[model samples]
Target: MNSLWSGSERVRIVERLKATLAGVVELELLRCKHLEMVDAALEDRASAAANAAELPAEEGIRAPGSTASEAEHGSTTSRRQQVSAILKVIRGHIGACVGPVFNPLLSPSLSPGYDFAAVLEWFAERVDRIILLFDAHKLDISDEFSEVIRALKNHEDKMRVVLNKADQISTQQLMRVYGALMWSLGKIINTPEVVRVYIGSFWAQPLLVPDNRKLFEAEEQDLFLDIQSLPRNAALRKLNDLIKRARLAKVQAYIISSLKKDMPSVFGKESKKKELIANLGETYHRIEKEHQISPGDFPNLAKMQELLNAQDFTKFAALKPKLLEAVEDMLANDIARLMAMVRQEEAAMPSQTVKGGAFEGVMTGPFGHGYGEGASEGIDELEWVVGRDKPTYDEIFYTLSPINGKVSGAAAKKEMLKSKLPNTVLGKIWKLADVDKDGLLDDDEFALANHLIKVKLEGHELPAALPEHLIPPSKRGSSLEA
Candidate 1:
């Protein structure tokens, strides 16, 4: 009887182990299936987005809603809403370092230019610069690279080329490679020097030798000299100046064209003159609000004092109608003055340019535009255009049609908020709507709220500039005013 009991216990143990192994296998399969589903969804969404982006502008699409009106508006609005949501979520998960967010190893290529180009276009409307980094050892310039380079050159002087992997090659080899790259690239692009290259392995460190202080010091000096000899800093300054000038030029051309179109109507009748004056007043108010300054505050000494404290000469210049219309030309003159100042500053310094800001490794190519999810080092403040009253992400995406797909999840929430009045404006309207001081909005509150926004558009002052009180006093100057 004892022998039989022992045998049964051993058999039970064996069965338990089998069950545990089977459970692990099942879990793995489930994970694989989930990943596959995610990939398929992403592919479908990407294709839809691409098609929507190409749709003609005549189609009037409302924001994404379940209603027939939204569907008829075509998929453009839906796509943008979807993309924005995905990006927002992806951005949030970037630093988590846990599971595969997007298949990191899906593409083996070090620098995929086509993928990079799409990213550039998305950022073009939002930022002034885009930097691309490459592993010099694996550098293979493809058609995609040419396309990106062309697009960047045409857009403005904001594209920078960074060549990485310096520690892998000897100093002599690095210099030779740099020269070869510059010579080959010089023929194709206007500014060969703009393709900045640097050599250093983020993963590798120089070997330290014990009791060899002199040798170590000599090696360090050599590295410093090599870095100094690189022309990256000079190249970046030139590029920044070039981009600023280009932006100014584009603005100038637009103003001139607009003025030419409007010149005929400016000289009509007394009635026309009155109408024009009203239009001009409205225009002035719109411009002031767009710059986030109060309409009443303008024409007041206090406002001018505020402007001076802010060092916002650009906003001051924008207020003048002649300057507003000719903003491009005005900006061009500003750029020229800025360039002269930079040159003067450089000349005064022993080092031609300060090795700081975004230009630090300009020549050595250490600064590449390739930023990973977990790798963004500094604060990223994005400035993009939206209509008066601080349009929401949904409104901007619907207007621009930058991304193409069905909006979902957190993106939907953000878009919903964006479509409504801004929080500050909403808060003000809510205050006016809520006759009772309770926090929640009931039926009466909702009806009154709608009425307020309708009237708010007609005569309401832009929401009190996002209060500086929200920001720490030390950082108030840098915070974005809603």
Candidate 2:
């Protein structure tokens, strides 16, 4: 839902020609600023959307299995509980919201240092997808960036290479450039599968070469569909990562205990420890052969060697089979049960209405057939009515433009003052007029307001609350009777 793009200058500032802790701090500050902008933009869009689609006085998608009367009055307990559960899960996860409230240590990158290499690693972990932008006219990879590409190679599934400004080259030239780019990547990535490359002129300006316009459009859609699938595939991806981590942890435990058991109990401890560190690769192979585990699950050899050089292997804890068995059991049995529960929940949900290539809302079932089976029966005896001329009332309501669909409490108060009624009498009318208690008056509510004002002006006392028959039909979830 959000993105932080650091330009070349910003990238250089973070690198500082050498690794520095200040670069990480600087990136955090930049992220905080970007979050502020995203929030402001969302708020503006939400407000505009609200004004554009003014719902019936009652707001919210009515929860399934609730009485229509309950939705008309307010949210039901079951609905509230469902909402609370969703928010609880979402708010607890880091990067779940577009805000600057998450702990920095909990951020995706394993590295605490934010050098150029570390930045790429952090981004590879943080984002759902990565796009490597390149100029198609001159395809080249600098030697300085080889380390960064190697880090990205670990996340090849998330990577997509884009040959931007491709229209600047002819069809034959683009073919040669793409081939060269793949050759360069094959050397750096060390992967068997070829990288997926998108070729296009990704800007507002017209394409220099129109021959590939159709091809470019299709490529653009392919990228969009890939990005769109991220939200849907997120849970599966997290579950897969959990299984990978569990496998890696089991391997690590075995490696550590093997080293500890190899240490000398009496003399020559230093020489023995040095020898183990020197032959760490052999230890990994031995552990893999004994346990029948994949070598890929082992930690980075160079990094592990550097860490092991300073460790006293004899102090390492012995591997506990019970702990490893429990993890394996959870992965094999408990996770399968969890997935079954997810499928059950998905099947029990209501189908949504798709309008104009977008999901609109839950289908309320056919109108007048009853909102559900028992809902229509509850309000069949009552209906909304105004005592005065509706058109005359609507003419006055329409003048409250842009927000003409709804009038705020203060604006309604100003108009009610012209009635010359006492504040006490006006207060009661306002309460009855705003049937939904949302503190805003739509067209029907505004007409209901004028009807009530006329009643009070004629020396009739207003009720404490609007009677069921007089409650706006929109709020009562029923249309006016002809």
Candidate 3:
């Protein structure tokens, strides 16, 4: 994968992560605080429901203890019980998984303080895509690494497998290698669909076997295009992940609630727990039938059973219908609204294209023109400076800086973010754009910055400094005014 950040920014991220990792006492405190917050939220929701229940009925409506009221009350109680059961299950798991221990031997390095699970979660939230590179010649997957990959099943959508060093072997051999790789991965990744894999020799050397060169080039282009789309679809990906998590949580609550209900209150709890674990398949079907949950939503049977074996069923909370209803509402309504907003924002965004990489001329601008094609009209003129794009850039500048016709460094940074250029590249563009060195951008500077961004996006090199003719005509001989 390409490095997203410059050297300095990468260092800063490591420092931030190091600081975020706390000592044992601090971690314990944080765990307690998190539980308290959960309790407070549950209390708030219960109080709201109670208040709504107390509200007087309309003049011609039914009174307390009516069939409708009793039904609503029972539903709410059932939901509360379910919520408690889910919490018990969650708390039990959390209690068993202790934080990283502080080791004296790893003094200078901070690896001792890093919790692998915590670090993985942090990186998953920030990173858009994860490419798992494999050497085509070696198709074996170690048990330890396979387990690690299996743990990331939740984020499998973000994963892309790359079969590298394909050029080292003949096309016939490549086919056999690819088949072996897929067979190995199928044993590890528990999914019905096949994982996407890109086969290419990803290096600066010549291909030893040129028969499949075109195929490799096409595969490389597809991989780069997939990486390029990450920024545009990030919001949607996040929303989708959230929805997936909610569905899984709801399924887990159902399973736990069913188990809790099956356990005897005063006796046979241990034997009942054993029986439940032994017949987990039946329990899963029963829960699915009773709650109308899809079978696909259920977690792996073996993993779920192993977790339950360590848990005490009697302590699990009863099923709470209201809690489940809230989750259902969020999945149905709240997430739907968020998805609509994301689509709206995407619809409003101007079309963009990545001009360089394994393929060229793959995409064109609004007028079906590729980069550097503006010169075909008979004169050598920079597109942003002489083409119809200037006015549009100016309009965007005004939108970003409405008040005084100038944008602060921060504001310009915010607008430039939409271009999805690397921060290192943007820093260079900013330096070239701020002609008069005022640290803020007037309309002209903003336009220049955007033009450079377009140049970079089109796979052209950026100049070390702004050229005289390329400079905005209005800002030509002015000092500290451009």
Candidate 4:
């Protein structure tokens, strides 16, 4: 068995296990427990890798000159023991018996299809979800298991296939593999229900992992603060209070004009006054009918007349603007506070982690070090300190901006963003900012940032203004004049 498989094969297995373990952790976060079998398989592989790594190096030993073959045999035994240990852990967690496992390359006498079918049956009974990890470098399973794959497609939502060792395969081969997998899956399941196929390299640096971890943790903290600052229930209560104050202000204004004493003259004739009083009753009834308020809770016509006799319109008029202003202030303060909390949370986060060679340009500092000042001169007076200039549109779009329009109106700035961004990043930004069902983003749509901030604080109105410079170039002319 040791002679049959190379060191590269073992390494590939170890890589797959690591990838699976990471996926398991992610699934755990999402509260999905259906991948217990896959998790167990991953644990087994990880233990084997650890055991292999721990073995003493036999660098100087030769097969004939030393006991190197014996040592290698012992290592192999240890590896098997590690694998068994992992399998035991998996079995314990799975709580069910699985079918016979076979090595397709070594076990030439045994039929791969028969073994695969048996395993599938075992999984169907004992596992809630199935994940097929294939070695694209070795056998092609798509053609061999076309019928079974079709059958599995009926449960595509419950299954996924990972094309392992994608980095080893040529681009054309990878596409052909993907196409075959998709075609086979589509035959078994509806297009919408088909399971996803991921082409991943476990050894490759994750595109977002460390940075996303920091971003998500910071986002969670911001979310908590946002929730704490503006409790929805409490805001609704305040809204009701503001509405009541507005109604009272309107009522007080009518009384201050001395209109109650000459109600008949104000309304018209005596009969008209009565009609006007009746109209108030009708309005109250209409409110009750609409379930906005209860007529029984309001003052009766005669009681209302008495209250009006004592009311002062000047006081009401004076309070009206104040109440409105109070509501506006409360909303604005809460919104500003929430935004501050978010910005503070983001600011405290570590600088974004750079992943892969692709992000190197973005991660590199504005200019090379030592280009500005030499270190030994105790901050030489001759050396110029970098000016605190605001970020340019290009800098903001490329280095500082999120790939998705999470920064607001980022998609609308695509032409500007394209100057320095990759097409993949721009595509993601477009998807995020083109939220309105319309494909394009206009200046009005660009104001979504302000809208989001206002809505979060229970204020429906957008901010009084956006910065004139942030306005799109085409709209700036009209807006600046206004």
Once fitted onto the true fold, the runs of candidate 3 whose alpha carbons sit more than 4 angstroms away are: 1-127, 142-146, 183-192, 309-312, 350-482
Rank by TM-score, highest first.
2, 3, 1, 4
Q: List the residue pairs that clash in candidate 4.
A: 256-313
Q: TM-score of model 1 relative to the true fold?
A: 0.28
Candidate 2 per-residue C-alpha lDDT over 114-207 given as tens digits, one digit per residue, 9 for 90 to 100 = 2435445655665666777778887667655455567665677777888888899899998999889888888987767888988888787888
- Number of the top-ranking candidate, with TM-score as the measure: 2
Per-residue lDDT tens digits of candidate 3, residues 195-255?
A: 9999998898989888988678668768877866766776798778667666776777677
lDDT of 4 by residue, 328-390 (tens): 443345334434444555455454432434333422343322221221111233322111122
Q: Write the per-residue lDDT of candidate 1 for residues 84-149, one digit (tens) a residue.
A: 775677452211111111223123532222354445454543443344555546655555555555
Ranking by lDDT: 3, 2, 4, 1
lDDT against the true structure, per candidate, is 0.41, 0.64, 0.67, 0.42
Model 2, runs deviating above 4 Å: 1-115, 336-482
Which one wins on lDDT?
Answer: 3
* Candidate 2: C-alpha lDDT: 0.64
- Candidate number with the higher lDDT (1 or 2): 2
- lDDT of candidate model 1 versus the reference: 0.41
